[model samples]
Target: MALPIVAMTLSSCGRAPELRVNDAVVILSPVDSNPAALYFTIHGGPEKVYLNSVLSRSVIRSEVHESKVDPKTGMVTMEPTRKIEIPAKGTVEFKRGGKHVMLWGVNRPARQLKELEAEFIFSNGDRIIVDAEVRAATAGDADKKDAHSGH
Candidate 1:
């Protein structure tokens, strides 16, 4: 009896939950050779999921990264991250000095359009397309200590 009930419950929620991506922005590097940063928010739905990756044809390279504080050096370090786990009914923010995406070589079209349509892929094989505002990097963004200038 319990086995049957469990099977029914699982079957009832077979589909992926309603995940949403918002507040996406891609700031182009002022130097043109440096990679740009992408920040966004992922709102979880009824079930947990993993953010597999972010893709965009507008950029030459795209990757997910995170910032961590090194205990020994007492400094901040940025590294590449394969995936990010989003809790059920929770939210994950990709911002500066934290988990964020890096886009390299903003193409002419993307720069001209001033936006990048980024595809957020999930573990459940769902893809959410979002228009991320693109802006020119400022002098403050070139600060290497913050690691936003290049990485």
Candidate 2:
């Protein structure tokens, strides 16, 4: 009917929220060669998109990772992720106990600057560069440490 067509048209259209990254930060490890986690949020655009990669000129190694706790065992685990999907007009967050970027071997320059500049690449061919403030390790860092040490 006419009403159905109108609904379809409305559904097909969306107002992209400028497709940005915000509140980026890198939680630095006190020990050298230890891993760091990058957290941020991605505001969605006009269409569904995939976060392909998170790159850093400040660190030699980085990847998208997610943490999960087993319901039966109550054991937490971390795993590398390929791509993260962001729905249109929606938001995806990279936060502790959730999706985040794990980085290693942060060079002295980034530490001196107290920030890490990361590149967020998307499936829609949109790339966003964000400066994540570097901060000292906190209690939330224990999970990453446990996972790394196999403790």
Candidate 3:
């Protein structure tokens, strides 16, 4: 019985990490000249996962970023990030005024697209493809407000 239990535990430990993305959206630039922001909720599997980067043919470049507010100055800023860690059996949210994927130099066709397909690359050599809804900056105001409030 003890040997069987040990074998089961070892097999489970070797399982690959699973990732699921939900509520994915892309906020297009108002003038189609600036970078777009991508938001989503990512759920990790049994093991912790590191999100290394995002890839899309629609944009010239893409990177992960984190937003922060200066409590004293009341100023908001965004900083580039290399990786985002998703806790095991937990979720990470990328929303407005928080951690998000930045897409730069979006092509004209992509900007006009209703939805875009993107690939999320993990540090452990796993890639997941997802379709993200496109939204204009003027749209999703209610969602943005909630995101800013950290809800």
Best by the lDDT measure:
1
Global CA lDDT computed for model 3: 0.81
Tell me each candidate's TM-score.
0.83, 0.82, 0.77
Candidates sorted on lDDT, descending: 1, 2, 3
Tens digit of lDDT per residue, candidate 1, span 1-151? 8999999998887666568999999988777788989999999988889999999989888999998889999888888988999988899999888999989888998899888899999998889999999998777665645666445
Candidate 1 is scored at a TM of 0.83
lDDT string for model 3 (1-151, tens) is 7999999988888656567888989887665566778899999987888999999988899989888888997777778889999899889999888899988876767657778888998877889899898887776564454223221
For model 2, the superposed segments whose C-alpha errors exceed 4 Å read 1-15, 139-151
Error of 1 at 2 (Å): 33
| Local distance difference test values of all predictions, in order | 0.87, 0.85, 0.81
Per-residue CA lDDT of model 2 for 1-151, tens digit only, reads 8999999999999765678899999987767768888889998887899999999988888989888888998877888989999998899998877898888988888988898889999998999999999887876576444344331
Question: Which residue pairs of candidate 3 clash?
Answer: none
Error of 1 at 29 (Å): 1.0
